[model samples]
Target: MAAASGTRPEHMAPAEVFYDGTEAKKYTSSSRIIDVQAQMAHRCIELMALPPGHRCFILDIGCGSGLSGEALSSAGHAWVGTDISADMLTVGLARGTPGDTLLSDMGQGLPFRTGSFDGAISVSAVQWLCYATQKSHQPYRRIRAFFASLYRCLKRGARAALQIYPENAAHLEMLSAAAAKAGFRGGLVVDFPNSTKAKKYYLCLVAGSGERDDSAAAATSAAGAAAGAAADSSSSSASDGDLKHSDAAMEATDGMGSAMTSSGLVVAMGRRSSSDFEKRRRSRAQDRVGAHAPARKEWVLRKKEQRRAKGLPTRSDSKYTGRRRPDRIT
Candidate 1:
């Protein structure tokens, strides 16, 4: 199916109504979309701070057709997925996936017992809960219920990464505020904050502790320092290693600014600052300096070249091409 133009249905209806039979099938089968969801799920789990050990049970909320759960399964982690659409779950079950699947509306709350999973992940799911299509459905009340239930479902100190696509800053605030009211002590982590297509926001939540947020920042700083140290070490090595090491260091610093670490801290992501925009404006200004004003003769020649390229009639370039002709001598 072709993507919708101008307007998105996701912004309007409840997920269950929007993701019916063919829509669910098409969503599950689209390779491009599948890859995107997989990448997002990987990032979401990574932000969860799950330990690197034996397989741990994870919750995949709004796991449309088990796409996100597939990512968890590939990583050797066991997952139980829940979605509002029976059609989506049907598609997931048809795949013979390893993870258990549930048919449930996230706004109503998850069905699991308290401390049921090691960690939880939801990709492109939570924000849907922000809309209320029916009078019976209250956005704030529903979000609070889901977050509180999710908070109780995870083991203490276990983080939940909810990848959300808020329509605007207000929607984001609504979701975050609901989570906070539900006793979740973490904040939103935005990846690639300056880019439009590549940006992602994960609502990282800690079940019982407030210090996880600080710990996340500390972890990011430490990772950056380690990367910096390695670059310095590589500088002392062979000349060829310096370039590679410096690149690695720069990448580490970039990642540090991107999001949280794996099982480390629950740091909130920062937005692009005014200074960043100023730097970009300065670079753009520098690039355009002397670009607008061209030598009169050179300007005529360049315009002539452009016209010729377009196969348009062009005046022959001459010193007098753009100047008034001198008065004819008597």
Candidate 2:
């Protein structure tokens, strides 16, 4: 299929057609794919931030060959994996992947009852919904239906971390918008954003509002305790002024950084100080003034000095430096 044509499998053929018995075997046998999938699965679990030591019933959507499902099992969770490819499921079964495997298409929707799962995760799968290989397949509608079904299957406040490799900005926006329309709250989280190949995207969605509030409260309390411990340690190691300066710098740089608690709840931590805000406001005002201000002797000299320091071509300062020329007689 796609492998034979040297094109991306998603673009070459439908997932079911692309991941046939040969591809399923090849995928499961590859050490690199296995490692990457495992790493991604663990990261997804970390992003889920489920309660420590608590066993969860997780749904693995598009769980090709049960690679991600294996991760769930290792993490002491019971998972039910659903995939569009029967060959992949068969291979997973042969490989003895932990938990159940079902032959199903996620685009058609998850075949589970309401609140059937504690949480959900998908790896390199959700992006498939953005493509329409078949004539009847409407990408937007399929995405909406899949997300709505996912929303209904998750318990209130439960989260789903769907790892996707979107084709472009439009695909990413469409997937996120569809999730939002399906009543899932939250946003996309990108990891290793600067790295092209290493970068990954996860749509971190919450099923409902109540669990979100509870998770936030829990994260806040946990963050407070952690902050207190950190402060105590810093106080012991550094002077009070140094500690305050460091804290202020952190607040300025990490304005409202997210903290994920044990309960899979992400909460915003840290706040921009009033002093920081005032500084930024003053800097902006200075920029505005500088934009229109007439060049003064000091400003011109300062710019020349900066250019000179940077090893750029700069004329030597002379008696006429920054001096205004006499207006030409009209």
Highest lDDT against the true fold, candidate: 2
Q: Candidate 2 on 59-106: residue-level lDDT in tens?
A: 999898899998999999999999999999999999988889899988
> How many Å off is the CA of 63 in candidate 2?
0.7
Error of 1 at 248 (Å): 34
Per-model lDDT: 0.69, 0.72
Give the Cα error of residue 263 in candidate 2, in Å.
26
* Lowest-sum lDDT 10-residue window in model 2: 237-246
Listed in order, each prediction's TM-score against the native is 0.66, 0.66
**Candidate 1 clashes between residue pairs 3 or more apart in a chain or in different chains:** 49-263, 216-265, 216-266
